[model samples]
Target: MAGSADTLFMPITNGEIPLGEGQWLYLGARAIDGGFPDELRAALVCEQSMRGAYLDLQMRGMNVSPRVDNTDRFSGALILIGKHRGENETMIARASNMVSAGAPILIAGDKTSGVAPLRKRIAAFAEIDGSLAKYHATVFWLRNSVDFASHFSSAKTSPQGYQTSAGMFSAEKIDKGSALLAEHLDENIRGDIADFGAGWGYLSAELLNRFSPRTVHLYEAHCASLEAAKENLSDYDKGQISYYWHDLTREAVGKKFDWIIMNPPFHEGRKTEPQLGVQFIEVAARSLKPKGGLLMVANVTLPYEKTLQQNFSKVNQLARRDGFKLLKAQL
Candidate 1:
């Protein structure tokens, strides 16, 4: 579904999938080539953060906040299933509930994303209207009904005290790189701080445990993960925390900080995009005071040293172990 337009749009193009006369909802809608037709009233519910997709959606003037206040009211819905099984199931469940009974809810995904099992699973419970195959992907529609709500609303089980959702960086446990950086953090990290891509609040919580910074901003791109981070760090004083569900690469950080710490994401879909971390480095540089410091961890193989050197006045490697490297970049 990443680059294949036909998977979701073919039916609409071929006139098999009819757009609602009123509003329709899009769940986890990735980069649509040119976005939906002008006539269609599309509402988006995207939780994951792909910088390019966010840019595309923003350019289309469809930058709806991921947190929709009143849900389960759209006349029809379309879900672009992602690679995470739990996320896919949760989106499908939310999609099913969004549209009413007998309204269309189309699920689109490629073969490699485990679309077959999901199709079968939903077919067993929901009323399958029909399906079409193209570009090694399947697009199937099921009539919305409350009868199957509990089955598909979400994937249930999580280990004890887990505070993350599916598809987030280090969702299941503390990331090794983050953990290493947290362990080796300077004892005097006490000024205005920012965690660039704070995932599920692990490093933020660690920072709060160690120091009482004036303010700790948690900038995360994924809405669900941001929500989880909120819960994970709920016990902390309100004034000490600021959470921003934002596109780190495309958006400005608003204010400069005394220090920035992160384990920046280096992935774009199924590919390793080292430039992602590069962009984060650039953003950190722009959002930090001249005397500020940046502490981050990365995979040993990711090529970030040159970018770090170019952006920071001083860059040094603090530690390297377990296939991860910890670096400090000072302005």
Candidate 2:
């Protein structure tokens, strides 16, 4: 599978297609790249390029899409395939730091999202495989499962710091509606900014310590919260913060923002899909610049303020409490 020739099947979004055939599947991120069912794109075939993976529908507000950009066209064993339990502990900690010890590692997902309690905690030592896919469920392990550094160690969760392993997503605290929308940010939010779903980075460190934005793109589409927001924005300034795994509702980062903070991710995991917060309020009003603004937050009976007033003409709520609210708009 170098520069590419053939043999790259890759389909697993409405899964199935495996009985037998020339095997030319390529439907990732759940068919038609996440929006699914465009007649399964005529059951696809003639492939030259078809890459996609999931979760970035505006910061882990996933619907799946992203996985085939051909990262150097791999060449080796690092099997941690399938399932989407918040991307299986950052795909098993980057497949145990890029496999190299007896290789062949595998782990699948969707067994009610826990992969059956993570295959009953990596079942003894590996060689485990649980199947059942009426809708979703799978697990397969090999790289000495129980000794993958003793049941996958490394765990740190603070008042929202970083370091998380063993399947992500609220990997312990700091997500109470994103800490109540990071204490209602808005220190009058200055220039270039963005934090839409910057999950494990705690609202991009509260918008870089209270609206210190000159540039702040924590975009995130969950590769374990963009690897914990790139180690929590790695002590800032690589040009005033940057960390984009992308997927803010299908490509459009034409770059143009005055501010775009968000707590907008009303369930895609437990299934409450408020149209994934109205597709991140219509892709944050097409990546605002005009009247530039979008301070969303949700939960207080999520309808998303009539789709943020039909995609940001101007909607406001500012703050609420317990049930959650926040929501400020402009564009």
Candidate 3:
């Protein structure tokens, strides 16, 4: 959302969370195993923004979409909350819009995802039906009396002059590493460029404003962040920028670039996955021109140095500050 279910449908197994008969909206949906009610599965109009999860649902034969359609009417809803609180509320707001008052909105998540306080937060707005705790997780259903879901604004403009939506990394403020990287991008960086894992187009927007590149290819995994990137970088989209809603770890970019810049994500859920950043380095190594180079920022402790050295013919530490290190690698 393995590792995430085998902990949402527990309430369904027990009988405390009763879903409605017609199409049910499922926010942040993913593949589940062992004892998911088949009727509920059939009724679910599953919505997942992450490309990998969306494809996983499709592969499992579940009805899934990257985004929700307003035209669809749902009798009830199920939400599997994530680590971001604003994004969870955004999902709840959308679910409120899909179903009428008194329709059940069943929400489930682990404590690390902050289900306890989230329940309290929503209780201030709507009415709770019932709750259960299992597998270090909590599942609760609440009647959606607040159907209109009054203007919960999840989108905001950062001081960096770009639009960011909820759930994106560093949505409200510039990430310190990215800000440092943006400040330190090589003055000589020109021509075709790529921003791997571009979230809300912050780095790309900075690149477009500070330097003139022939084109900038932005690759991001999340649909919402990619959508925000499109909106944030609209001015540069005339011909200077191209967006790809892609899982870069599993797929490679088609066109090679003169320079690749990134502030790669290392966290997968609560666990740190260094291999993801390694894969990103491999992608950058392959997707750059023979004489091209990479510019990136990362935490000083991340184990990417060996990967960089292994992939590129030459690697250097550009600068180190604010607990981050900037790297330059050329093939």
Per-model TM values vs. the true structure: 0.87, 0.29, 0.92
Q: Report the candidate with higher lDDT, 1 versus 3.
A: 3
Q: Quick one: ranking by TM-score, best first? A: 3, 1, 2
Candidate 1 lands at a TM-score of: 0.87
Q: What does candidate 2's lDDT look like per residue over 12-78, in tens digits?
A: 3324223222212222223222332334333332211111244222132322233333232112222
lDDT of 3 by residue, 1-331 (tens): 2434545666665666666467888899977865346786688888999988888888777888889885766888889999987888888888888886678888889879999988887777666878887777888887877743463444565656667777889988988899888988756788899999998888898888788888899999998899999888888777879889899988768899999999999999888888889999999999999899999999999989999999999999988889999999999
The per-prediction tally of clashing pairs is: 0, 10, 0
Q: Tell me the lDDT of candidate 2.
A: 0.56
Superposed by TM-score, candidate 3 places the C-alpha of residue 262 at a distance from the truth, in angstroms, of 0.4
The RMSD (Cα, Å) of candidate 1 is: 2.9
Model 2: residues with Cα > 4 Å off, grouped in runs: 1-111, 115-192, 200-227, 230-232, 235-257, 261-268, 275-290, 294-306, 314-331
